[model samples]
Target: MAKRILVVEDNDLNRKLFCDVLKSQGYVVEPVGDGRVALESARSFVPDLIIMDIQLPNISGLDLIEAAKLDPALRPIPVLAVTAYAGKGDEERIRQAGAEGYLAKPVSIGPFMAAVKGLLAQVGAVAG
Candidate 1:
Protein backbone atom coordinates (compact mmCIF):
# COMPACT_ATOMS: atom_id res chain seq x y z
CA MET A 1 0.00 0.00 0.00
CA ALA A 2 1.14 3.52 -0.66
CA LYS A 3 2.08 5.43 2.43
CA ARG A 4 -0.54 7.91 3.64
CA ILE A 5 0.45 11.49 4.41
CA LEU A 6 -1.71 14.12 6.13
CA VAL A 7 -0.79 17.65 5.04
CA VAL A 8 -1.84 20.35 7.53
CA GLU A 9 -1.32 23.71 5.93
CA ASP A 10 -3.58 26.75 6.07
CA ASN A 11 -2.38 28.44 2.91
CA ASP A 12 -4.32 27.12 -0.03
CA LEU A 13 -1.45 27.32 -2.49
CA ASN A 14 1.04 25.66 -0.17
CA ARG A 15 -1.41 22.95 0.79
CA LYS A 16 -2.21 22.25 -2.85
CA LEU A 17 1.43 22.22 -3.81
CA PHE A 18 2.34 19.81 -1.04
CA CYS A 19 -0.58 17.53 -1.77
CA ASP A 20 0.16 17.53 -5.49
CA VAL A 21 3.78 16.66 -4.98
CA LEU A 22 3.01 13.87 -2.58
CA LYS A 23 0.35 12.48 -4.85
CA SER A 24 2.75 12.50 -7.79
CA GLN A 25 5.20 10.55 -5.67
CA GLY A 26 2.53 7.85 -5.17
CA TYR A 27 1.68 8.57 -1.57
CA VAL A 28 -1.90 8.96 -0.37
CA VAL A 29 -2.46 12.58 0.55
CA GLU A 30 -5.10 14.26 2.75
CA PRO A 31 -5.01 18.01 3.02
CA VAL A 32 -6.43 19.96 5.98
CA GLY A 33 -6.71 23.75 5.86
CA ASP A 34 -7.98 24.29 9.38
CA GLY A 35 -5.65 23.77 12.31
CA ARG A 36 -8.57 23.31 14.69
CA VAL A 37 -9.66 20.14 12.97
CA ALA A 38 -6.19 18.80 12.30
CA LEU A 39 -6.02 16.39 15.19
CA GLU A 40 -9.43 14.99 14.46
CA SER A 41 -8.49 14.60 10.82
CA ALA A 42 -5.29 12.83 11.77
CA ARG A 43 -7.14 10.45 14.00
CA SER A 44 -9.56 9.56 11.24
CA PHE A 45 -7.06 9.44 8.38
CA VAL A 46 -4.35 7.76 10.44
CA PRO A 47 -1.65 8.81 8.02
CA ASP A 48 1.79 7.30 8.02
CA LEU A 49 3.27 10.79 8.06
CA ILE A 50 2.10 14.31 8.87
CA ILE A 51 3.42 17.42 7.09
CA MET A 52 2.54 20.29 9.40
CA ASP A 53 2.67 24.05 9.25
CA ILE A 54 3.67 25.69 12.52
CA GLN A 55 1.95 29.02 12.18
CA LEU A 56 -1.79 28.67 11.85
CA PRO A 57 -4.80 30.90 12.20
CA ASN A 58 -6.32 29.46 15.37
CA ILE A 59 -3.76 27.10 16.82
CA SER A 60 -0.04 26.51 16.65
CA GLY A 61 1.27 23.44 14.85
CA LEU A 62 3.76 22.93 17.65
CA ASP A 63 0.84 22.49 20.01
CA LEU A 64 -0.70 20.00 17.63
CA ILE A 65 2.52 18.02 17.47
CA GLU A 66 2.72 17.92 21.20
CA ALA A 67 -0.85 16.78 21.43
CA ALA A 68 -0.29 14.05 18.88
CA LYS A 69 2.73 12.81 20.73
CA LEU A 70 0.66 12.55 23.83
CA ASP A 71 -2.00 10.52 22.08
CA PRO A 72 -1.13 6.84 21.93
CA ALA A 73 -2.80 6.28 18.57
CA LEU A 74 -0.86 9.10 16.91
CA ARG A 75 2.41 8.81 18.80
CA PRO A 76 4.19 6.50 16.35
CA ILE A 77 3.33 8.61 13.33
CA PRO A 78 6.25 10.82 12.38
CA VAL A 79 5.61 14.51 11.77
CA LEU A 80 7.44 16.73 9.29
CA ALA A 81 7.00 20.31 10.45
CA VAL A 82 7.09 23.20 7.94
CA THR A 83 7.14 26.81 8.95
CA ALA A 84 7.26 30.19 7.23
CA TYR A 85 8.79 31.88 10.23
CA ALA A 86 12.18 30.30 10.73
CA GLY A 87 13.22 32.17 13.78
CA LYS A 88 16.19 31.26 15.94
CA GLY A 89 15.43 28.32 18.24
CA ASP A 90 12.25 27.62 16.30
CA GLU A 91 13.63 24.38 14.88
CA GLU A 92 14.66 23.26 18.31
CA ARG A 93 11.23 24.13 19.64
CA ILE A 94 9.49 22.17 16.93
CA ARG A 95 11.74 19.20 17.53
CA GLN A 96 11.02 19.40 21.19
CA ALA A 97 7.36 19.21 20.35
CA GLY A 98 8.06 15.73 18.92
CA ALA A 99 8.37 16.35 15.20
CA GLU A 100 10.72 13.88 13.59
CA GLY A 101 11.42 16.13 10.60
CA TYR A 102 11.50 19.91 10.04
CA LEU A 103 11.55 22.30 7.09
CA ALA A 104 11.21 26.02 6.59
CA LYS A 105 8.83 27.80 4.24
CA PRO A 106 9.53 28.78 0.64
CA VAL A 107 10.22 25.05 0.61
CA SER A 108 11.69 23.67 -2.56
CA ILE A 109 10.28 20.45 -3.97
CA GLY A 110 13.59 18.65 -3.58
CA PRO A 111 13.97 19.13 0.16
CA PHE A 112 10.26 18.77 0.79
CA MET A 113 10.08 15.35 -0.86
CA ALA A 114 13.38 14.37 0.65
CA ALA A 115 12.07 14.96 4.15
CA VAL A 116 8.81 13.17 3.39
CA LYS A 117 10.59 10.15 1.95
CA GLY A 118 13.12 10.07 4.74
CA LEU A 119 10.48 10.13 7.43
CA LEU A 120 8.42 7.50 5.68
CA ALA A 121 11.47 5.29 5.25
CA GLN A 122 12.29 5.57 8.89
CA VAL A 123 8.73 4.59 9.79
CA GLY A 124 8.86 1.64 7.42
CA ALA A 125 12.11 0.40 8.86
CA VAL A 126 10.76 0.53 12.37
CA ALA A 127 7.44 -1.04 11.44
CA GLY A 128 8.98 -3.76 9.33
Candidate 2:
Protein backbone atom coordinates (compact mmCIF):
# COMPACT_ATOMS: atom_id res chain seq x y z
CA MET A 1 0.00 0.00 0.00
CA ALA A 2 1.10 3.55 -0.60
CA LYS A 3 2.24 5.39 2.48
CA ARG A 4 -0.12 7.98 3.86
CA ILE A 5 0.97 11.58 4.45
CA LEU A 6 -0.83 14.31 6.33
CA VAL A 7 -0.01 17.88 5.34
CA VAL A 8 -1.04 20.55 7.84
CA GLU A 9 -0.68 23.95 6.29
CA ASP A 10 -2.81 27.09 6.55
CA ASN A 11 -1.82 28.70 3.30
CA ASP A 12 -3.85 27.43 0.37
CA LEU A 13 -1.07 27.63 -2.16
CA ASN A 14 1.43 25.87 0.02
CA ARG A 15 -1.02 23.17 1.00
CA LYS A 16 -2.00 22.53 -2.60
CA LEU A 17 1.61 22.43 -3.68
CA PHE A 18 2.51 19.90 -1.04
CA CYS A 19 -0.52 17.76 -1.73
CA ASP A 20 0.24 17.69 -5.43
CA VAL A 21 3.87 16.84 -4.86
CA LEU A 22 3.13 14.00 -2.50
CA LYS A 23 0.37 12.66 -4.70
CA SER A 24 2.69 12.59 -7.68
CA GLN A 25 5.09 10.52 -5.60
CA GLY A 26 2.32 7.95 -4.91
CA TYR A 27 1.66 8.97 -1.38
CA VAL A 28 -1.90 9.12 -0.08
CA VAL A 29 -2.07 12.77 0.85
CA GLU A 30 -4.53 14.45 3.17
CA PRO A 31 -4.24 18.20 3.56
CA VAL A 32 -5.72 20.07 6.48
CA GLY A 33 -5.86 23.88 6.67
CA ASP A 34 -5.82 24.35 10.44
CA GLY A 35 -4.17 22.81 13.45
CA ARG A 36 -7.45 21.77 15.04
CA VAL A 37 -8.41 19.72 12.01
CA ALA A 38 -4.83 18.59 11.79
CA LEU A 39 -5.12 16.89 15.15
CA GLU A 40 -8.36 15.22 14.23
CA SER A 41 -7.09 14.13 10.84
CA ALA A 42 -3.90 12.73 12.30
CA ARG A 43 -5.90 10.59 14.66
CA SER A 44 -8.25 9.32 11.98
CA PHE A 45 -6.06 9.33 8.90
CA VAL A 46 -3.10 7.78 10.71
CA PRO A 47 -0.57 9.06 8.25
CA ASP A 48 2.81 7.43 8.12
CA LEU A 49 4.38 10.88 8.06
CA ILE A 50 3.28 14.45 8.64
CA ILE A 51 4.48 17.60 6.89
CA MET A 52 3.46 20.41 9.17
CA ASP A 53 3.59 24.16 8.74
CA ILE A 54 4.45 26.02 11.91
CA GLN A 55 2.31 29.12 11.55
CA LEU A 56 -1.06 27.38 11.31
CA PRO A 57 -4.39 28.73 12.49
CA ASN A 58 -6.18 27.40 15.62
CA ILE A 59 -2.97 25.84 16.95
CA SER A 60 0.56 26.38 15.86
CA GLY A 61 2.32 23.42 14.26
CA LEU A 62 4.93 23.43 17.00
CA ASP A 63 2.25 23.12 19.64
CA LEU A 64 0.56 20.36 17.63
CA ILE A 65 3.82 18.50 17.26
CA GLU A 66 4.45 18.72 20.98
CA ALA A 67 0.99 17.46 21.71
CA ALA A 68 1.30 14.60 19.24
CA LYS A 69 4.58 13.51 20.77
CA LEU A 70 2.99 13.45 24.19
CA ASP A 71 0.21 11.22 22.98
CA PRO A 72 1.34 7.62 23.03
CA ALA A 73 -0.80 6.63 20.08
CA LEU A 74 0.46 9.51 17.95
CA ARG A 75 4.06 9.71 19.15
CA PRO A 76 5.53 7.08 16.82
CA ILE A 77 4.48 8.82 13.63
CA PRO A 78 7.27 10.88 12.09
CA VAL A 79 6.74 14.62 11.62
CA LEU A 80 8.66 16.86 9.25
CA ALA A 81 8.20 20.48 10.21
CA VAL A 82 8.10 23.02 7.38
CA THR A 83 8.42 26.54 8.60
CA ALA A 84 9.21 30.01 7.25
CA TYR A 85 10.84 30.71 10.61
CA ALA A 86 14.37 29.85 9.68
CA GLY A 87 15.77 31.85 12.55
CA LYS A 88 18.66 30.72 14.71
CA GLY A 89 17.99 27.57 16.72
CA ASP A 90 14.77 26.99 14.81
CA GLU A 91 15.86 23.57 13.64
CA GLU A 92 16.86 22.53 17.12
CA ARG A 93 13.58 23.74 18.54
CA ILE A 94 11.67 21.75 15.95
CA ARG A 95 13.63 18.60 16.67
CA GLN A 96 13.10 19.11 20.39
CA ALA A 97 9.39 19.35 19.75
CA GLY A 98 9.44 15.75 18.41
CA ALA A 99 9.81 16.41 14.69
CA GLU A 100 12.06 13.93 12.98
CA GLY A 101 13.16 16.53 10.45
CA TYR A 102 12.72 20.20 9.49
CA LEU A 103 12.43 21.97 6.17
CA ALA A 104 12.46 25.67 5.53
CA LYS A 105 9.51 27.23 3.77
CA PRO A 106 9.25 27.48 -0.01
CA VAL A 107 10.55 23.95 -0.17
CA SER A 108 11.17 22.57 -3.61
CA ILE A 109 9.59 19.33 -4.79
CA GLY A 110 12.87 17.43 -4.92
CA PRO A 111 14.01 18.14 -1.38
CA PHE A 112 10.51 17.71 -0.04
CA MET A 113 10.13 14.29 -1.62
CA ALA A 114 13.62 13.29 -0.58
CA ALA A 115 12.88 14.15 3.04
CA VAL A 116 9.56 12.33 2.93
CA LYS A 117 11.14 9.26 1.34
CA GLY A 118 13.94 9.21 3.87
CA LEU A 119 11.53 9.36 6.77
CA LEU A 120 9.32 6.70 5.28
CA ALA A 121 12.31 4.48 4.63
CA GLN A 122 13.38 4.87 8.22
CA VAL A 123 9.94 3.96 9.39
CA GLY A 124 9.81 0.95 7.10
CA ALA A 125 13.12 -0.28 8.45
CA VAL A 126 11.99 0.10 12.01
CA ALA A 127 8.72 -1.66 11.29
CA GLY A 128 10.34 -4.48 9.42
TM-score of every model versus the real structure: 0.98, 0.97
TM-score of 1: 0.98
Instruction: Give all candidates' CA lDDT scores.
Output: 0.96, 0.91
Question: lDDT per residue, candidate 1, 28-101, as tens digits?
Answer: 99999999999999999999999999999999999999999999999999999999868999999899999999
Once superposed on the true structure, which residue ranges of model 2 sit more than 4 Å away at CA? none
Candidate 2: TM-score? 0.97
Clashing pairs in 2: none
Error of 1 at 113 (Å): 0.6
Residue 110's lDDT within candidate 1 is 100
Error of 1 at 125 (Å): 0.5
lDDT of 2 by residue, 1-128 (tens): 99999999989999999999888878899999978888789999999999899988768789999999998878999999999989999999989999998999879888888899999999999999
